[model samples]
Target: MIHLEFNSESENEGIARVLAATYMMKFDPTMEEMADVKTAVSEAVTNCIVHGYEDDQGKIFMDISNEGSVLKIVIEDFGVGIPDVKQAMEPMYTTKPDEERTGMGFSFMEAFMDKIEVSSESGKGTRVIMEKKVTGK
Candidate 1:
């Protein structure tokens, strides 16, 4: 397992994705698997920055681990938590309409990862857990 903590900034999203990819290298994931994990990580980190922090800077935590063929990733933030997780996961439902946000972050994550679980509170925080099986290994 590996733990990462970074500031909830737009630039850090790339870093998070790269870190996830690098960590998965040991599993020898295929191009598709690598892309899927990177994209999912990007979406999770971006959510922490745009929705969780909401223009404010906060800490985002990520934990990655693997067992056999399954890779698990957890991204969390202690900023303003989600008020309605179900509604937020709905396609095309974005809180920032003015920003032209597509609201497809969660959808993409779900499509790419084998399983995803999200938990959040009104003020405590939000946590997104994603898991995928690397068949190429």
Candidate 2:
């Protein structure tokens, strides 16, 4: 298991992706699996920065672990939580349309990972849990 906590900065998105990929290396995942996991991590971290914090700085927590071939990831942010998680997950539905945000973050995450679950409170925070099966191991 690996746990990470970092500032909700845009640059940290890449860091999180790299760290996830590096940690998965021990499982000898395929290139496609690596890319999928990296993309999912990127989207999760980006959401924490662009939407969760929304120009404010906060801590993002991530926990990663594997059980057999299944990889599990949980990312959390203590920022302005989503008022409606179901609406937010809909494709092409973005609150910040003026910023050219495509609202595909959750879509991409669901596409790349085998399973994803999200929970949020209006004034508390948001948590995203994702799981994938790495077959290369």
lDDT of 1: 0.93
TM-score of each: 0.97, 0.97
lDDT of 1 by residue, 85-120 (tens): 999999998989999699999999999999999999
Cα RMSD, each candidate:
0.9, 0.9
Q: Scored by Cα lDDT, where does model 2 land?
A: 0.94
| Model 2 lDDT-worst window of ten | 18-27
Inter-residue clash pairs, candidate 2: none
Cα lDDT listed for each candidate: 0.93, 0.94
What is candidate 2's lDDT per residue for 1-137, written digit by digit as tens? 99999998888889899998988888899999999999999999998999889989999999999998899999999999999999999999999999969999999999999999999998799999999989884
Give the distance in Å from residue 10's predicted Cα in candidate 2 to where it truly belongs. 1.2
